[model samples]
Target: MILGCGLQRAKKRVEVSRTMGSNTGDQFANLGRALSTTASVLFSAQPMEETILSYSSPYKKLLHETITNTGGGSSLVKMHRDLNLSKGKNKGFQDIYANSKEFFKNSYSDSKTTFKVLSYLSDDLLEDVPRDTIPKDKNLITESGEKRARKSKKQDSTLFQGFEASLPVINETIEIQQKVTMNSDMKPITDSESSVSNIEEEQRQEFSLPNHLKAEKLNNSYSSTYLKEAAKSITDNLDLLEIQKNLAASEIRELDIKLEKLKLMRELVFKRVAKIEQHELFLEKHLNNVKDRVDMIIEYNMDKEISSSDDELLSRVSESSPRTGETNEDYETAATTPLELKDDDASPLLSKSIYQQLQAHERKADAPETKKAGSSKKLKDAGMPNRHRHRKTYPTLQQFYETGSKIASFPKAHEEEVICLDFDMPFGTMCSAGSLDHLVRVWDLSKKKQIAAMSGHLASISCMQMDQYSTLVTGGRDAVLKLWDIDKAISEDNGDHSEDTDACVYTFDSHVDEITAVSFDGDNLVSGSQDRTVRQWDLNKGKCTQTIDISFATGPMRSQRNAPLHNSVLLTKEPPAIGALQCFDAALATGTKDGVVRLWDLRSGKVVRVLEGHTDAITSLQFDSINLVTGSMDRSIRIWDLRTGTLSDVFAYEKPITSLHFDLDKIVISNNEPTIKIYDRENGNHWFCGEENSELGDVEFVRYKHGYLVEGRSTGDINTWAI
Candidate 1:
């Protein structure tokens, strides 16, 4: 029984020893485990053995070898007891570090929390442990502790010696970094006291940070702010430059458009200037021609010698220029004085005619038959009246036009100045004349005598027309348009009737002002007056059918005029007046004083086309089916293509064109000059009908058709030429 009791006590003793060993050994192993875990987390996935081995403590190799190779045994427990005895004041630090590392790794998963727990535990341990218990010298309570203590003391001495050696460099580097940071974030510290205070404040912040972190904070602050500001400034500059570039591009485009327009305008001006220069040269050439012709005729007259009878004939021709076909008793005797010119100013055409007459008188006694045959052939080929087939000489007078000599001349046909004239065409058997004396006379070309006279107009006749049916239409200045039967007027003038009926078959009076122009085409009559309106008349109805207001069709237009009012010269502006008119079947062309020609569709009374080129009042206009020809006081005749509304041809004359007529073959124009000008379209030739010594007067009204030219002169003379 005593032996059994001893065994039980022995077993109890072994149990107590094992429990004590496990408790103490576990505390040491846990202390090493917490340190290894902290080092692994801070250094990133390092092995437990290497982490433990990196420490320079005397127990480092043993702890790493035991944990990695042996795991746990008696030697580890003995080492733990030895460590407890050697570091008695750090016992609570070991326990807290081990427990917190377990909590951090398993539940917290943060190295920062582990370090904070270690720091708090270390602070409490330092407070709880007695200062006397802390070891001061290298000596230890055990033999192994003595060796570990000695090694630790040697390592501490070395570390303190190295720190003392680098102390000045570390301080200088920190001071320089602090100064740079202050200058960037705030301002320069010029005052010594302020600089010292700023240094103190920076030192306090640096002290709170770890030694490694102090240098990083100093390097990053100033450089990041400076780089951001510089980048922002560069971005702003780039944006501004981009805006300016876009603005410049837009301006360049606008300038390009304006430059193109200016170029076109310049080209147009150049063309107009060139045209004006060419017209000036043409006028000068025609003037030279006229002067040459005049000089040649004068020299010829001066060089010739004449007999007394021829001289007497010439003097008689020059002196008593009486009405054609007067009795010989009315002739005055010729004076002994020679044919003379006052101040060498004789009419060039007059001298030429007198010289030709003398030559003709001399030739008549020798080959009178030969002369008559040649004259008859010339008249027949030239489309003269059939009277030339029977008569050997001109009907009334032996006068000639200066250029194309005339076949007949009714000199002094009217009691006053003749204003208008017309004749039947193709046959050319009858002719009519109207005068400023308000009398209309009809002449029979077959008999060479005046056969009819009608006196109904109260004012001067301005325009007249004749149809194939013995119908005559005349417009007078008294705003009266009269139509007469030519046959009845002639019968009445022959004293064939006893009735006192007026010759006027129709008298329409819709015009309110002086009629300026009139046109008659078959059954239609169109008239224009200074009232700025065009009236279309139906002869079948004998009334005004359509009235086109010039002002309404053309709108308000201004013309420049120079007039003497109240003895003062002033420039005036007025609306354009209707100055010319032409009518076809349903088409009418009206010209305004402003030089605008408008083509009207009479059915609708609306302007269809406007022809613009003349710069003054239009004096005359005539159009065929395909072309419109207009004459202006501006000295230009423009022919326009009606189908295309474009100018096809233009004729520039030396004097203002007074009257114009054109056909398919030729264009005839009469200006202020005594000559009648013809433009032959087929051969592109210009012919003047008046020559150097022709007694042609300034023709006021003229008509040409079927190669016959009838001109009414301002001197009350009527002449015909076959061309």
Candidate 2:
């Protein structure tokens, strides 16, 4: 038995020693595991820290050798746990190590829990870790960190230095920009403001007036100069206007004066015209009265001649009455009772007596023996009255011989002076006076009585001519020519005329001036006028045939002034100024105021001859069968032989010879002398004279038979004388 107990004790001692050593090793492992796991948890939770600590571990050689042989940190942690638990747990001493098992379980649980809490603390602490606290494993981190630190320091330095350095530059640049902008903006504004101020100044200057206009305006504005200047201008204008008005008024006044003068002159002229007209009327009335008396004398003379012839016829019939009737008284009365007077009023006894005388005169004449006897018997037996026989006889002037030496004379026929005279053939005459009163007298030459008075010519009877074709043509200064029919005038007094009888057959209004004379040639009439023209008219046609222009040759005479003899002789030589014209067939003879007489051939329209020698105008011309007798103011009568165109004879008188007449054997001359003179043409001697009781302005003489004279005087007196 003693040998078994000693071996058991020794085995127990050996097992206790082994368990202590294992417990010590297990505690160490648990402590290290706890530390490792805590560190791992811290590192894993902070990966940047873990990564940094991996290289910067305090046990870097051992941890590197340990992790290098193992898989990594996780594998190391797992292996360490396993080795600690396995080695720390004892199965053969189960009853002796049961308390250690609980200890181990609790430690393991706490460590794992501590590891988890540390892991969470590490995660929380990572956001707060500074970059400088992060450990670097290589120089890369250290160099990078150093570089970054240097760069950051440089950036900070650059930022702080740049701010400090750029402040003045930026401020200076902005100030320069602001100054440039301010200068640029202010330059234009300054220029514009200056321009505006200059413009306002210029406008203000322009509004001020010039010196002249200013002075003028001021003068008219406030002082007495204003009123003075205004008054001066107004006065000048008013003076000019007044001058023009006065000129117009002067013109009007002149017109009024001229009008008044013209009106007064017109009135004076009209009054003179009226007085002239009244004077002419008086003259015309006297002329007409003389013409009527002349006509009455002619009728009375004719009646007296008829009565004397009848008295002779009745005396023969009474002597033939039977004494102591041889047969019965009734038978004797029947046989001689005016021869049983024929029913025809014609007187057979007178016809038989004239026929017997003519036959006796023929028988007394010798005849040719060869004349047929039957012709001689027929000439003897043929019986006709001598009523158709014409006697070429004229009246003689017994007083003309006594007054032959006198050129002019005046006789007392009437108390008034005789201005004109005309003869009414067969015992009638007319006369006019120079009185302004309108009167003319007609006288009967046979009875020596005034017959009637007639009037009406607006002017003096300047010239007169008798047409002798039962009409008288007269002209006057009234510029009119009137024709009077003498036959009709006498017929009206006889109470045997028609109411339509034309007393005045025609009138002419041709002369623009005074009619100086009128004359007729056959049926043609000629008029002379102061218009210096002689107009030839066909009185029947009542139209002008020719206008003879004598004005050109007679212009000097028209301008002549009637003056005293010595003064008038100093005037220019006057041409033949026509005063009267006479037509002898187709030839015209003009008596001119200039004493020269002109003869014109009507067909050739030229002057044939100018008869000179008279010292004054030819007052009258008488044409005869062989001679032209002219009476002139030269107090001489001249006879022209027409065939030879020569002055045949000249007779001198004491007065102007106003008229001349020619008969077959005698020449009669009338002057202003109150007598008519008869001259024997063959002897050129005064033969007979007929005296008148008035100035014989005109005269006509008719010779009836031997020594019988009939003379007409200006006093409308006709004297019959037996010489």
Candidate 3:
């Protein structure tokens, strides 16, 4: 029986042993499964832990206490539950757990290790295991909870007071571990056992730990002191980066501004260069023109020198009479005698003395011959011959018109008529035409001849005048005021006969339309045109100096737009007629088609007065020392007091007076009628009359030194009478 009991007991012991081993294996499997589940739960609950950790200091303290009481392994479950109950209440419990598992798995391997460690301790030691080894059991049970509460309170105080101060050291240690794992030389932890081995190995070689670990330990000891310094460093670096960015932006802006300024400067330089080139070209052209003008002046002076030498030679031939039967050489010797430059060269005083001697000799040579009486000194000029015998017979009327009418009959015929007969000057001459022919014949009663045929006018000559240099200036419908050198043309014909007739010494092309009248000061020539414009021409330079518009009083003609016309005639209303142009000392007077006499101050180009009273066009105008006399188409002659611009007298004429003149004693007026009448300037009384004629154009008067009056008629007739 004993033997059988022993065998049975042994079998029973083997069976019990087998059951225990199976139970232990089952428990290990269960523990491993539980650890795996815990690990998954911890991982899934990572976001909840992070949310709790990110709270404000006081809130984080409460959360840390809750976590410690729940235990590290179960904290994730509790966090998921609490989060679901709080703001994340919409999430399903299972979904929350799943997401948390993913989060922890990505974040940390420690989560799985911690759960596995706790599971192994619980399976091996059962209730005898330390509370910390089985953190979930201890955290959940009421008895261990109290201990955790007390520990958590103490931790809370430290956390609130100094947790921030330890964070840097903890981060530094974590960073060191990460660096070791990332290094190419380091081996990876392949299994949990290997991880555990590595941890033990790390602890054993503490003295030979990596530089990162040593740095971490030092950081932990000094972290609280360095926290503010590290923060300050980060902020300073940020500020420096911002400063650099701003400086770069400012530099870009400055570059843009500089580029714009450079562009403008380049444009200015180009303009300056172009202007300089233009100025250089203008200077070159001006220099060339000046050179040509200088050359012309030199050539003209040379010609004058040659002409003066020829005159001296002719004067010597006239001064010395040649002997009869003299040889050609003898005559030539007398004529070629060089004038010696006298030492006491004709003194300035001798020039005047010589003129006085010549006048005295003329008087003696002109003395009448005396008849001798019966006795020696008989009645000293015995009674000059009968007054009738001494009387010079005047030419018959027919002879005056036949032989004396020739234009060459006048002395000094080479000179042009400077003053018109209508002017107030004592020697002014008038122009006349018997037919509609465009011929203007000027007669001088002093010399009794046709002085000039003022031609070159397309229409009937309307007005004429002369400048200071005796240039025959005429204005007509041809839109031109020509300055003719009557003397030069005549002298050229008589002397060389090769000079061109079309050649004018000087010409002005200033008037745009028909030249109505032309007058001159000593320096400037003034012309009035049908275009209602007045231009002042510089006589010496033969160019226009200024032009003034006068169309304000009479509006511009619309028929003529901006078209340019040549010297061709166009039909318009009876064309403007210029009655007279009178120039005083410093003023100019003009009578126009409107019968108004306007006066202008030449120096200032200002209108002085408008003399108005005539009802018809003023045909002729004359000015005396005190009065201005005007003959008009109204068949009357009117005189104006110049100083006051008032009418002094009006004399009725039988016909419209066409010409007027003031002869020291009377005013003479000529019209188309036969008779020429003279009126006294003071009283407007009829003074004298000339022989009748069928057609008369103009009349003029001549004053003699011996008080005689001479008259010239347009029909080539002249008469002289005592004043």
Candidate 4:
């Protein structure tokens, strides 16, 4: 609208010029043309400005696309038009066009045409006129720029006047641009000078030193010298530290090697120890086998010697018998002498008396028969029994009791406590010990080692006895009796350390309670139990032949159901247990816990007599054909004549008697003390056979035969003292 108003004013001025002269009208015409051209150029620049601004501006397209995308169903053209119209005039406005590419092309063409038209007009207007024709004026400046050092020149022509008005402003802009260019060109020099000054100030402050210090001017050379020295010293120290580190590493490697060697040595030592232990075990097993073989060899030699001796004696007997020159029956009778002696001496005595009576009759009838009988007697005297050779001369039991010392101690007789011990009497070569471990161990007294270990009893063996024929009878707390063949046990033990199979000959479970005492003579075995009964068992029958109930209380008798030997005898209504039992010939002597000794006739099974002299329980008692020896916890040993039933002798001790056994000449007694006391019946001498401070323990059982006294201790030791 402003351009249009300018054109109208120019047309009105042209009419006024036409009314003036032709020259004035021509100048006005030119001025009008210039104004029109300038307007046209301004109008054409709008499109070019939009093109440049849109090409450079990210904000405009972002705003347009954002609105276009965000408007959803809204018109895309309407949103783009609104974005175009919202750009402020400062950004230069463009006419609404749907295609920005077509708009950009049309704007480029218009800009080219506007530039050519301006150039063509500028070519005509920039004619180089004479300097005197152009006027320099000051009043053409605007009133607001009064402070301007320079002003526009006035011109006669209107176009020249407008041009001259803008010239000073353009020149002012040019000058300001030149000033900015000059400052930019001088920046490096100014910055370089300022940095140099800052450096000098910093150096002056840093090395200013303190008062009273005097030195030459500080320079980089002095600082560099000390820095080099410090660097050299640090490098030297680093080298030394590296050398030390290398040495330390070497030492660690050597130590590791040594540790490996030590580990190998330790492993080797452990292996060697294991090997040695295995070898020791092997040696121990081999040693046991060797010992078993040696025992077998020794037993074989002893048997061989006995057989050889028997052969020699038979030859002598055969040779000597023929010299007597008797009939076949008489020779047969003479040949059976050894057999009759083994059974009983009575048959041999009766036979000999009959022969003597016949010889007396023969002597009365003929003198030749008497001489033959006397010569036969001399030959019999020369042919002594072979058993006499085995008999060795030894001190009597009294002499042994006085001078005997513990010649041997067998500690490992049983694994448990020894409760009872018995020897194969007369020789005392073989002895058996019963222990709490339910095992009976037999030891060879001559060899001093265990020969057999017998296990059969279910409970601890309370009492045991070994007869002359190697027959062992053991009674246990199980109230059962077991018969063990000592010969079989010894033979089986030749192969192994323990004998189990066939070691027990028989187990007799007849008693109902613990068997306190047991004794056997010939075929009859008697056992006394806490059941207040005495039982007699037949070895041939393996059954109880008789049970004598001693209790005065009237009750059902388990023994009377069996065949009764005789009428029963009742005594002691308080019921005393038979503690001590001894069987000899046809009599059974039982001592009750009440200290009364009863002699029962085995043929009648009736108490023949009761001997009551003991003040305490009878611990042990033994009777022969003539005398009865009884030892009691009352500390007294009483000797009573079996026929009279009267106490004949009383020997006292300081300690209570534990066990006692007597023969025709001497009585051997074991008391609570370690010693075994002996009383010589013929010499009236009494002595002990143990040390005063011996470790014999409490003697549980004692056996004295020949010259040796063997006592079993509760400590599982069977100690022997011999003279």
Candidate 5:
């Protein structure tokens, strides 16, 4: 019972130590169990030995020698002898422990004897027990009794002395540990608090026991290391995800840069090729001139009657050079004979055209002489462009002016005067117009209806264009250019022609001033603004990628005595803005309000030439392979030879030109006189004409199906005509 009580006390002490963060409590607990187990084994080993001995009190001295070892009782007795047990205390403690266990056991098991045992083991009975076994100096009450129960006072040494001796060694080890660690402030650990701190760190690093024992340890306040590992793993995964996302973004950026570079390179290559082709055409034309001179020489020496012309092959008076038809008889005989003339020399005699024809003949030896109209051997033989030989040139003065027929007209095509127009797309019979009403209107020639109206500009719509597929692009005085997806109207879809168009695919608002003109050169958009800037936009990026400052490209503004007025005010000084813009292969043609038409190499941003003719602000300009035509408020249309940079011709108009339309055989002039007139290309004679009953804003000869006209008028209407 005493052992059980001591074990319960030790258990409670371990709980308190664990709470205080002491790890050595577990070792103490193990030592206590070992002692309790050994004592119990000793007591059970000799249970009946004492009883039998007392009963045979007569033979006590003689029975000692006669007793036999039972269940190794001799070894147990020897163990007790070697233990150095305290003499009186051992006997007293054993008796009290046995009495307590018996009393407690009987009090619980048998109600009749429970009271007797309880009284026997109570505090009164304990007071009657021997009191000399333990010493009071060692904190024991029984040993300090007034009588010397044991004859020797020095024999009462205690286990507490040994326990006290080991404490210093524990403290020294703790001090050593303190020297190895740092404090919260990172200061050197000191021996003053070493014992307590070392015990806490050791307890925290301790491991729990078996599953059943770990139940209590799990409730400990300190968190386990596994929780930190889990959190670290999650953080690592997040970091990895961030790295992957960044890499993917970098890859996409690289692809975009590569694509943009490729587009620039493609444009450059195409321009170079076009230049090379133009040069070849020029060289070929010069070569053909030389060939024609040679042909004239061949024709001169033929057997025809010759007028008295200069001669270099004759002596003073005889003029006895070889006969003019001297080789005729020889040519006839040689042509009939198999003469061994060199094929190489003969090849040089053939014209490039003749050479191609012979080669084509050889390739299609079995083909019939008949041919397709646009692409045919007959057109090649006729010395015409095989691509469009069947197509007629521009109408004659009589055909366009006197013979044109009215096709269709829209009386209310826009809310205000139309300002700009563009055709030449494959729309079959449709035209697009921009107006001062800040809207873009689409008119169908066949149906004669306003198919759609696109509005986004905050100010007047200054310029409008349609791409090859009839995609609409418009720019306005608001400095904004918008690209629209108008495939619905272009395709003539029967589903929803009445619905208003949606927002533009791209809105370019980079210009700080009004946008004067916008044009598409292939997929890229070039826009000139009153900000004195021209920007090239990438369709894929929906943003400008290049800017050209034309500040250095202007010519001196020519003053006019009688320039036109707008809002009853005479235009005075030069406008520091781009008024007209056009993009071609590797080139940008910009006409400012100063009437100076400057052609810039768009890629290099360098001015190639400045064409000066118009005396007032440039209204419109057009360019083909051969000539540049400019119309202005000076009431004049000037044509410049593109090759020679010289003014080729000039025509006077009755009023300021609103627009100029150039073709291979005609130049259509539209002015503020409410009339559209046509002129013959060969003779420059005015012939056919039309009337809007108001100032004409713009006009365009229909593409593919020529002689058909779409006109934009000042009174907010569209008119279509035919020749």
Candidate 6:
């Protein structure tokens, strides 16, 4: 409508000019053309503004198609018309005639033409013009005598004044936007810079800059709005950058902590290395000292042998050299008789203790009263069994595990399965053999012969313990306890089995059931039996001095079934079965067929604590210190810390364990599979294997003579192996 009015005014001007003259009409024509061009440029800018404002601009596809398919002459106007075409259903927007992806490409030339057209017209209208085109203008300026910067009142709708006033502002704003678009200093959106669209909604409100833009800025230059938006984008990007920086700092702190830990570990490693080095040096010195001692001993022994041989030959020659007062017959008798060595002539090779004892023995032979000192305290002390077990250099646990080997074997040592065995290494002699055969067989290890078999038990011997002077006390299934004089049995050849009660030196038939185990603790004999009782025997009186009922304390073993029971199973009532038993200092730990291990306090005759976990009857038990290992019919061996009455470790097997034993760092277990398994105690790894324990044997450790494992099989095989 504005352009039409401009054209009409231009026509009117022509009429007025023609009335004046032909030269005046051409000036009117120039004025009319300028007005018309400015109006055309303003109208054309509407779609271009829309294009720049929206990413989904109508210009893009058409412009793109035009540039790519220029050979097809696809123009901007043609593309716009096709986009407006309607198709099927509502016959709407999807219908297009001259356009598709194939025809669309960017038309940069068309965009440039539009910008150039606006600039050309704006420059012309505001720039060089003929001086003859204008008269001394009437009211062309505001009442202040300068053109009005803003309208004072509403302009006449019919006049072109408002339209002319809006034109220059539009032109300058577009020019500025174009400059910003082409500027190198105005940063382009970068991939690293967070988009204005992606900033959190809450954050956008929080970091929002004040909206200071007036309506004039929106319609005209829009400089303030652009600047405000630019500021907000910068702030959002700064916040994102700050967040990333904080995350990086946290990671650095974690890395620093890890670095400190590494340094501490390095320090520990250094300390350990220093200790190891010191140990190495000490070991080297020790080795050198030991080498010197061994060499000296070897040299002394060699020299002693040579001197002794020479001395014997010289002594014989001297005996034959008769003195003037001595008869030849007397000299001959002295030389022919054994050369008895006096104290001064004793061999240096003999140990002091052995030599002293030999001298005493000779004196005792001469004076018979010395043999009566058996009851003397000093003599008892002197006769205490040698507890010093001769051992080789103790090997490390790892060395034992990797290189374990059997050292000895004694096959068929008993007629039945040897339930238990004990060693009797008396100070003056060795008679170390006892089995479940109801007889104590004494083996002379020096002579390698079985000399005496002390027999007394009427039933299978269940348990036995060796006392001082080759004395052995045994408990049996017949519920009888018998103490044997091992030396007397060997020297006197006493009848094996004696039924006369008065003839038996020490025999107690106090137990009501089979005696399962026995332990010699100091002066007392602690015995466990199937009668659910542990009796401390008084050897002097030949009777049970104290009895702790293990079956059901304070209750009868068999009662009327309907009677309400006052207590659970205790020491008085017989237990299911006393399968295994062991005695410590003041307590007895007993394993039963009911799968419970009870620890009884000997003084109070009461159960101290009961440990339970096995699902099947316990078969074997071995303990060191307060720690115990029990094997059960459940095919598992569980270790317990008896001090705490808590289970500590478990080892599972395919077969029920029949017997088990352990030392400081090794565990040896025999199962129904007839095989024995040895494990490293700390690691629980299977360390070695042995087949000697096959056939359900009783295994015993011979720690004195040699570190040998002895197993007595049910199949009448006894094998001792080096460990």
- In candidate 2, which residue ranges exceed 4 Å CA deviation? 1-416, 428-444, 450-454, 493-502, 552-579, 687-723
Q: Which candidate number maximizes lDDT?
A: 4
The model with the greater lDDT, 2 or 6, is: 6
lDDT per residue for candidate 6 within 1-723, as digits (tens), equals: 767887898778767867864544554555565555545645675665444323454444333433333323334434434434532344322333223333433332354543332232212133233222344432222211244232245322221333433444466557555554555245565621333333333334643233443445445664786766766656544544454555567789999999999989977876666455445534643543344344434422332544787889989968997756734332121111122433633677643232244445555676663422322212222222221112223222212222445433445655645555555431112333333355656554323445566666775665666643355677776678776655455555544423222212466678776676677654467777766677886443344668876566313443324424332122122233666777766767778777888877778777878888999878777676868888887889898996787888887977777667667767777664554567676766884456544444433322221233445455545444445
Candidate 6 structure lDDT: 0.53
Better of 5 and 6 by lDDT: 5
What's the ranking of the predictions by lDDT, best on top? 4, 1, 5, 6, 2, 3
Estimate the TM-score for candidate 4: 0.43
For model 2, where is the 10-residue window of minimal lDDT? 382-391
lDDT by residue (tens digit), candidate 2, 415-492: 433334444332233333221312333444434555444344565555566531334667665567765554445445
Off by over 4 Å in 1: 1-403, 426-435, 495-501, 552-576, 693-695
For each candidate in turn, the TM-score is 0.41, 0.37, 0.37, 0.43, 0.40, 0.40
Q: Which stretches of candidate 5 lie over 4 Å from their true place?
A: 1-402, 424-436, 489-503, 551-576, 692-705
lDDT of each: 0.60, 0.50, 0.48, 0.61, 0.55, 0.53
Which sections of candidate 4 miss by over 4 Å?
1-402, 426-429, 494-496, 553-576
Highest TM-score scorer: 4
Error of 1 at 341 (Å): 74
- Model 1's alpha-carbon lDDT is 0.60
Runs in model 6 lying further than 4 Å from the true structure: 1-404, 425-436, 444-448, 467-469, 490-505, 553-576, 692-706
Cα deviation in Å at residue 345, candidate 5?
Answer: 62
**What does candidate 5's lDDT look like per residue over 433-493, in tens digits?**
5444655666554446756666667777667776433456787766788776553444444
Tens-place lDDT digits, model 1, residues 146-186: 33332332111132233443554467668867776666567
